[model samples]
Target chain A: MNRQELVNLIREKQSYLCVGLDTDIHKIPKHLLSHPDPIFAFNKAIIDATRDLCVAYKINTAFYECMGIRGWESLQRTVDYIPSGIFTIADAKRGDIGNTATQYAKTFFETYRFDAVTVAPYMGKDSVEPFLAFSEKWAIVLGLTSNEGSKDFQMQRVGEGYLYEKVLKTTMEWGTPDNLMFVIGATQTAQLGEIRKLVPHHFFLVPGVGAQGGSLKDISAVAMNADCGLLVNASRAVIYAGNGEDFAQDARRAAQEYQQEMAAYLAEKLAVKQ
Target chain B: MNRQELVNLIREKQSYLCVGLDTDIHKIPKHLLSHPDPIFAFNKAIIDATRDLCVAYKINTAFYECMGIRGWESLQRTVDYIPSGIFTIADAKRGDIGNTATQYAKTFFETYRFDAVTVAPYMGKDSVEPFLAFSEKWAIVLGLTSNEGSKDFQMQRVGEGYLYEKVLKTTMEWGTPDNLMFVIGATQTAQLGEIRKLVPHHFFLVPGVGAQGGSLKDISAVAMNADCGLLVNASRAVIYAGNGEDFAQDARRAAQEYQQEMAAYLAEKLAVKQ
Candidate 1:
């Protein structure tokens, strides 16, 4: 999906929400447990319930993989089930040798039909560029993650700046804002201002709100780009809002809350653009 | 497999060779293309052909993933087919949020039953530490890659040393040598001496040796540790050595050449240890 279509979808729904379809079978409702494929069944219900509230869906492949082949089938079905207008991400953190990585790009973009894929930048541009080569698809590289252990390397002093900053500056050269986005976790709000200065024009997929205790208001304030700048994801809080049969309804309510909050951010973004 | 067992297997086969099972459907023999699952058939042939000659099997998930559900099934079967004594790697290059990575570790280690996984360290330790938490399983972190684009950020001078060097030093603390390893490309042999000094005790999974033109003799000279700490891999040169019906036989021959060279390295390693 193009950036403008994403912007318009957010405006039309008054929501900059991207629901993380990180469907773990054990966490899904008991009612879906009886279905031949519980994960996909739960995912379908959640998507149908929240589609009006969300503009994107982030499918983390690890949960599906934990279920093995059956889980992958569910993931494929879920990807196909999502409406064409919404953005789809194979939230696969993939990066490796170049030729090997080129095949990964092909797998997600051609085989799985994802609009974008999250990439790890430690191996540098070759690892990330293969994902960028696909026309109209996005490569969301990890910038500063929202985890306690980020201090180990991401925040360490590398050169004139922190390692994350060096990664941002160098990786920006491999792809333009149109195809390259950064994964700036919501908890790292203070660094958002500094990250924006490094690559101000690119979009960011911000996670760590809700269950992770990151403030939506703070992330929007500092990390917003001219294009409304973020897809704030809330996984457990939104998806497993209630584990009962009304899980879908509870998920919708949770998503609507984030959408309403994100609406205001997008409105501010539109005002600045005007 | 424990550290001593892995070392013993390496010596028994007279090889530190890790055959990359990057089984692309199109690259396999045409006879297997008609099978219900082509990827698995191809992997089974290659494994059965070269199992005795190699110490480990590196399964790159991308090639199998290009086939979607069927591809994942092949990946599962391939992992199952390899002998228990040999090291198995899910070359997924995965790293994400901590809880998410914990699930990934469960998928590869618990579900798929792999001995190790190649992880990207850009998101820092939280992205990688979860993978290291599992006992006996290893987390192979990205160091200096062999790709041309590696110069983009990995090789950039950062204060006193390169960014990758800082990654190596900082990430070393997350796990011990028994559970942690680094991916130092075989072509980057010039830096192996320095890398050896940085993480002298840990094992390294080195790719790019044969078709990528890396020298086995040189990497062994500079990167070998007291444990014979290396799993030098060659994908295309070994697997695609002959595209005809005798492809598997050619793969065995190619693997033998590397194994013969590695035997000398192991002997030298024994001398040094004594």
Candidate 2:
């Protein structure tokens, strides 16, 4: 999905939740294990339960990749099953040399048909530029990540500012708000407002909200723009809310709760009408 | 393979050359496209011809990942085809949150069965440490990359030294030299000596030779340790040496050239008998 479509989605749904299918086979309800593809079955249920409540679906590629070829089949099915017009992100934190990045760009955008792919900016501009080349496809590069390890390099000072600050400022020069975005972890709410002001027009794919102990209210308060320039992701919180036969229903409840709260935030922050 | 096995392999072979199987479908000999699995067929020929010449085979996962499920099948087949003694690397460059990193480690080490997987260190210690969790497996984290874009973040000074240096030093606390390695690009010859001094025992997987314009002699002179701690990689130069019917033979000849140069460097730097 392009920038305008995504903004319209948040406006239309009054929610910017990107339900993550970071679906691990071991974590799913036991009853679904008998199915030919439990991962997809689980994801299908989650998508069905939450489709109307959210505007995006982010697939954690690692969860699928660890299963080998069968996992890929599950992934293919899951992506195909998601109702289109909603933004889709291949949360595959891929980065490499120039030519290699192009292949990754193809993997998510052309092959799997994700609307965006998460990229690591460690390899710098060329590593990220390939993902931005595709029209309507976005490259959501890592800014300040939620994990503690962000302190190791990203949070460290580079010249006058943090490495992530440098990342945000310099990376903005490479692409516009139309094709470029940043993955600003919800844990970095302290920096979120400044980050939003720093990169005013660009969107941010905000993870680390639900299961990772990040406050949804805090991040939304600081990061929302005129266009509701934030896609707050909640993975485990919604998908693994229940373990019984009513798991999908429980998931829907969890998603609706997030969407309801998000609607309130949208109305309060961007004056986005429900 | 563990550190000792890798060291012994380098010593026994009298070469630390890493044959990069960055097999691109469009670039492979058209005759091989008629095979049941063209990518695997091409990789098999290259492996058969260069088995004894190089101590490691680095598979650029992006090349295979772009082909979708069939690409993954080819990757499985090619890795299975490689001889047991040689180290195998999945040059995936994946990094994410702690749990996500664990899944990537499993993707390359457990599922794909590569001895080592290259990791991007942008997410910090939690991202890299999981790859080090597996016994006898390796996480070759990016220290400094070969691309011009490396100047963007990696070469930028952080605190007392470069960001990549902070990465090298801080990351050392998370894993032992036995399980840790760094991808030190050949283009950074000016820092090669200092980097070797900074990191004496750990191995460096050097890319950017040949097609990327890196000097084998320059890196070998400054970076070689007592154990000859370098696995210099030449991907396209070795894989696409010739695109005709005799491509494998051409590839073997290219690998032999790198091996021969590496053998001379091993003898000169480490004073090991070849």
lDDT of 1 by residue, A27-57 (tens): 8888888889888899999999999998889
TM-score between candidate 2 and the true structure: 0.98
Q: Write the per-residue lDDT of candidate 2 for residues B1-274, one digit (tens) a residue.
A: 8888999999888889898999999999999989999999999999999899999999999999999999999999999999998999999999987888999989999898999999999999889988989999999999998899999999999978998999999888889889999999898899989999999999999999999999999999999888888999988999899999999899999999988888888878776433
| Residues B104-192 of candidate 1: C-alpha lDDT, one tens digit per residue | 99999999999999888777767888988898898988888888877877887766888789888988988888899899987888898
DockQ of each: 0.72, 0.91
The superposed Cα distance between candidate 1 and the true structure at residue B62, in angstroms, equals 0.9
Q: What is the TM-score of each predicted model, taking all chains together?
A: 0.96, 0.98
lDDT for A162 in candidate 2 is 91
Evaluated on CA atoms against the true complex, candidate 1 attains a DockQ of 0.72
> In model 1 chain A, which range of ten residues has the least summed lDDT?
A151-160
lDDT of 2 by residue, A151-213 (tens): 888999887889999999999999999999999989878898999889998999999988998
Error (Å) of candidate 1 at residue A152 is 1.8
